[model samples]
Structures are given as C-alpha cells and as structure tokens.
Target: MTEHDQQTDGPGQSFESVWDAIEDTPAEAANMRMRSELMIALKARIEARGWTQAEAARVMGVTQPRVSDLVRGKIALFGLDALVGMASAAGLHLEVRVSEAA
Candidate 1:
C-alpha cells in the first residue's frame, strides 16, 4: 500500500488508530484506547496471578460474569470509572499523563 492508503481508509480520509477509524469523534477514540489499555492490563494481571474468573471477581469485588466480560474484552460493557475501580481493588496503581497532541 502507498502512504496515502496507510493514512486513510480511502482518498481524503485519515485516522490515527482503529478506534479513531470506527468511533465518531477523537474524544470517543481516546476513550476507547484508554479503556482498551486498562482492560488489557487487568486481564494480564489476572492471568499472571493464575486466577480463575471467580477468583478474579473476588479479588476485584465484582461478579464472576463481570470478570468474564473483562477477560473477554467487552469494552462496551465497561466505563472508565468501573475499570479504574476494579484496577484499584486488584491492588494496581494507576497514573494519568496528559500532553499536547501532535
């Protein structure tokens, strides 16, 4: 593919991420990206501890089905607040950094 193709879905289109391509706005894309990152971290943490969904749910103070949704990456089913709370309950420390966009 050419540089243009790499930058766009078609002529005169551009996106920085898959979320950007699919989401209606830059803010939505950013939200999805952050949620995805958090979900991935949580899933990895659970796996690294060899925890089943039930075990993870207990540790995170959520239901086993909720843990299943998390591990399955059901991003639409979770909001940032919920994910952050779960992360906190799992003993994970989180920091947010912001800088001007390029």
Candidate 2:
C-alpha cells in the first residue's frame, strides 16, 4: 500500500485494533485525559465568546499556529507546563493538588 493510503488508515482501520488503549495504567490515563477535557472546555469557551482561532490566539498572546494546535487536540505536542499556560491564557486557572494516602 502507498503511504497516502496508510495515512488514511485511521486508528481502527485494522481488525487488530484494541479499545483498551490505556488499560495498562488507569490512573495515568485519567491524568492524561485531563488534557483532552481541558482542550474541549477551552475550545467551547472560545466558541462561546465568538472568537476564531486567530482571534483566540491574539487573546492568548500566542501565534495562530499555537492556537490551531491546541484546538486540534494535539495534547502530546504540548508539555504539561505549556498546557497550564494555555489554560491561563484562555481565562482559566489551573489548580494542582497532591495528597498522600491516609
């Protein structure tokens, strides 16, 4: 098959695909899921405010490419610190708390 065809194969294009992608570590995945949720919430906020990606970039004080990446759900492309900064730029604050087991 050509590279172009492989690119269109999507995640589940093969029968060997498994739904339990992160079953190896539920807790880790839960933490990672936060990034997805944040992106969605922020995207909704931007949409609610009637801002285009470019406009949102301006408000976030970032380049249009950065906003495009964020809105496109490129979580792995952004580091955790960068994500927190993005939240702040979107008018939302991030609060991280860690507690030891009782």
lDDT, candidate 1, 1-102, per-residue tens = 521133467889877677778888889988998899899999999999999999999999999999999998899999999999999999889999999985
Clashing residue pairs for model 1: none
- Window of ten residues with lowest summed lDDT in model 1: 1-10
> Which is the leading candidate under lDDT?
1
Question: What's the residue-level lDDT of 16 in candidate 1?
Answer: 69
TM value for model 2: 0.63
Pairs clashing in candidate 2? none
TM-score of each: 0.88, 0.63
Best model number under TM-score? 1
After the best TM-score superposition of candidate 1, give how far the Cα of residue 64 lies from its true spot, in angstroms. Answer: 0.2
